[model samples]
Target: MIWDAVIQPFADFGFMRRALLGCVAISLGATPVGVFLMLRRMSLTGDAMAHAILPGAAVGYLVAGLSLGAMTIGGMIAGMAVALLSGFVTRATALREDASLAAFYLISLALGVLIVSTRGSNVDLMHVLFGTVLALDDAALILLCSLASLSVVTLALLFRPLVLECADPQLLRSVSGLSAVTHFVFLALVVISLVGSFQALGTLMAVGIMILPAAAARFWATGIGGLLIAAVAVAILASLSGLLLSYHYSLPSGPAIILVAGLAYGVSLVFGPAGGLVARALPRRHLEA
Candidate 1:
């Protein structure tokens, strides 16, 4: 009975199988991007960029009526624009990066809502906001798989430059003139990952898998490699748990997955080895003569 309850959903339903695959693909690709975002202290930037893609997706819906290719292209364009524009603003103005990001995402979100209001029904809007993970078809799967492959490869090639740039921008620039190229390319990869994930997690909640797992991993891992491994593991587990919870409890799959990741994050916060609440709360001893 326990086995049937827990495992039968995927065994019985093709949609469930597809959804699981989609989540796993997303975790494989997006969680690493999340790790980079966390290391750059740009977690909030991921959230902002996620929102910035909305208007473009809404425009795609208006143009193509839920066409996967159209929305993906549009979202990618919008996200890249916001990222570049925000970077330009940070360099050009006294306003900090966070402030610029906040300003841009708000405008983007409002524009998206207005566009959806004028062009689409409430149901369409909800689908964009929450996603249709269980309804993923062949085209969606192909897009996600391709995106994951590309993101992983790109990250591997750029790893050294990215690390150098993050660690010391001046030093990296002095060593090579690839600093600007590296920054933009990294931003592009982030946008692609978010676009790929939008179908499973929606634009609003897409950052959950990326940020949450990476954040939890920070609590447990002292080194960058360990952090990436821990984050990917957490994301995969959360995806599985969320899918099962959604199946049995009749919950929304995207939110369910995010909630599971959130639960993991909470547990890590309390008991993680690095700097958890328990670690902080434990009494310290002094050396005696």
Candidate 2:
């Protein structure tokens, strides 16, 4: 019964297997970035960057139809451009990083939608906005797995400096010249993860897989390492559940996966032990005299 309900779907369908693999890769790569974004209080920044990729992707689609390489490259270029430009604006002007990012992303989003609508059909627009996980080809799968591997390794190298930066940016800048480098590199990782995942999750919903699990994990764990682990676990579980739901009910895979992750976040908000509603609501024990 369990096999038919849970395991057989992947076993029987190649597309299901591919979709699972793609989601797992996103969970591994993007969730860690999401964790760091949350720690840095830049959660909305992820959403902005996600939107920033859309115009580039739309341009790629306009030029090359649906060529994965073109779209992925365009997305990376666009995301990096926005990140760099935002950083520049923040440093050069009185504007904050978040504000700069918001401006760029909104512009990018509108421009992207306009480009796509001008050139492509509503179906193409839907694909760019929502993704086609079950239709992942070999090239897309390779791209997702390769990017995930690179993200994991890069995060491992950046772990110490990143933690320090998050906890005490002043201290890190004082001690190490790598502060700026680490910041840009982390942004690059974010861009790469989003570009790679946009193929499977689309521009609009890709950040959901990245951010929601990390948010949910916040309520479950205190340590950075624990948070990373818990977030990845939550993401993977949501992916599985979402894929199954989509298969059985004909739901849109991207939104379905995000909805499942959102559900997990809601549950953790209420029941998680770290600082969840239940924990906060419980009465404290009296201290001994």
Candidate 3:
């Protein structure tokens, strides 16, 4: 009976199957990037970059009226531009990366809302902001899977440089020319992951899937490999649970998935073994004298 409750919806419904597949693809690609973002102390940067994608996607909606290719391309362009500009401002001016990114994303958010409000109904705006995971078409699913595959391969190739850059950026710069290249490539991966997922999770919530599971994983593991595995595991679990909840309760699917991830984060914060509240509060076994 329990298995039927968990498994029947997907078996009976094609849309449920597609939504689950898309969410899985996003978790595979985005969670690892989120782990790196956390390691680099740039977790908020992922949120800012997610907002930066909105204006471009809105413009694409204006021009093409929800064409997947146009919106995806536009989001990629906007996200990359904001990332590069923020880096340039940090290097060229006195402003820090966070401040510059915040400014640009705020502006981008306002512009996006304005554009969408003028051309589309409130429902359309809601769709853009919150996404319709249950309604994913074949094209969107293909894009999600393809981007996930690309992200995995590229992250594997860049792993060493990324770790070096996170640990000792100056040493990485001194030792090899890969420092800047790796940084930019990693940003590209972020953009790709965000853009591909926006079709399902929307701009406002896409970064949640990226950041929350990774944050939860931090409390469970110390090493990069462990973090990656843990984060992906949490994300996949959240996706499945959230989809089932949405199916049974008529909840919004995107937010349901994100909320499940958030719940995992909360659980890890309190109960995880590494640095969770319970672990810290518990008396440590006295080290053998």
Higher-lDDT candidate among 2 and 3? 2
lDDT of 3 by residue, 61-118 (tens): 8899989888898889889988888778887899988899899888888888899899
- The local lDDT score (0 to 100) that residue 69 gets in candidate 2 is 88
Q: Residue 109 CA error for candidate 3 (Å)?
A: 1.6
Q: Worst 10-residue stretch by lDDT in candidate 2? A: 278-287
Tens digits of per-residue lDDT for model 1, 1-289: 9778768998999999999999999999999999999999999889888999999999999999999999999899889888888888987999998998888888988999999999899998898888888999999999999999999999999999999888999999898999989989998988999999998889877899999999999999998899999999999999999999999999999999999999999999999989999988994686796
Clashing pairs in 2: none
lDDT per residue (tens digit) for residues 1-289 in model 2: 9898899999999999999999999999999999999999988889899999998998998889899989999899889998998888987999988889899889888888899888899999889888999999999999999999999999999999999999999999999898888899999999998998899998888899989999999999999999999999999999999999999899989999999999999999999999999999995797999
Say which prediction, candidate 1 or candidate 2, comes out ahead on lDDT.
2
